[model samples]
Target: LRKSELKGLEIPGKLERLIATFFADDTTVYLSENDDFNDLQKILDDWCLASGAKFNIGKTEIIPIGSPEYRDLLRQTRFLNSVDGPKIPEHIRIAQEGDAIRSLGALIGNNICQVEPWTKVLERIDQSLDQWARSKPTMEGRRLIISMIVGGMTQYLTKVQGMPKEVEEKLTRRIKRFLWDEKTHVRINKETV
Candidate 1:
């Protein structure tokens, strides 16, 4: 949608003046600054009809951001706190502040800076490492797996979010330990591997 038209719409807050990001078929409309859910839905419907592209309401979600006070305000004024909103389509979901929404293989939410999504990835890595340890792979095999599979899995996420230093350290420790057959408190000589 055009910024000029959205500005004219009767929506609360500064989002009306904000421009939407359009990439190919995906259009990201930021409604976090406004609490006008009904008006926004109407605009989306009208846009979909005019563009001849169906708006997949089922895939659409309202992800609220900001502090507790802002969240409360959004809940009270925008009807996003509750799961039920008569004005909102039945298929559209409302994601709470702390809820994680998977987008492009990364977890996104209001507090994505915390790297909560990495926890899931860490768990999966742990499981895989455990299985690999039981199989007793050779050092060369382990190195290949770590450099290829594990590294590949996290490459996009690291590039996107840059991951927190602590999370990267933890993953490094885990990988090193796994490489050493789960040996703890032992130094690994990099040149040997």
Candidate 2:
């Protein structure tokens, strides 16, 4: 759905502070520090009814992003109803501190700064590279794979999440070894003319 269809879904007074991103069929709404979840939910329910679109509560989540104390505060608060007076069903899940939520191919935790998600991405890349290495492609072919496949995988994540320098270095070393078929322990030397 489009943003125009979901207009007026933001909390009344906090409209200026809300941050919402719509990509394809996914819509992410970020409320301000002072916004109330109940109010936003009500608006969403109303929008769904008005637009004749079903609100899939099963796929929806309320993730608290902050310190432990702040998250605890969220945990204590109970969400009973939407602004329109409809009760929220008990089957809808609220994300806990250690819960891993996938959003747009990136893993998210309660704390926004956690790097565990990036580790998962790295592990996937390593597995893919290992599988490709089994084919015994030429060094030039390996370099092309590194540039196109590996590089493309991290390009978006690095720009969005800011990968650590050490991780980049380690991945680079692994790619180098894979390029040489992991036979020689010595490093590959390039002599300039």
TM-score, per-candidate, Cα-based: 0.66, 0.70
lDDT of 2 by residue, 164-185 (tens): 7777787877887777778666
Per-residue alpha-carbon lDDT of model 1 for 20-80, expressed as tens digits?
6566666666653434467667787888889887877778766666677766665565554
Report lDDT (CA) for all predictions.
0.68, 0.67
Report the number of the highest-TM-score candidate: 2
The reply for model 1, stretches above 4 Å from the true place, is: 7-18, 22-26, 32-39, 65-68, 79-94, 111-115, 184-193
**Residue 102 alpha-carbon offset, candidate 2, angstroms:** 1.8
Most accurate candidate by lDDT? 1
Lowest-lDDT window of 10 residues in candidate 2? 79-88
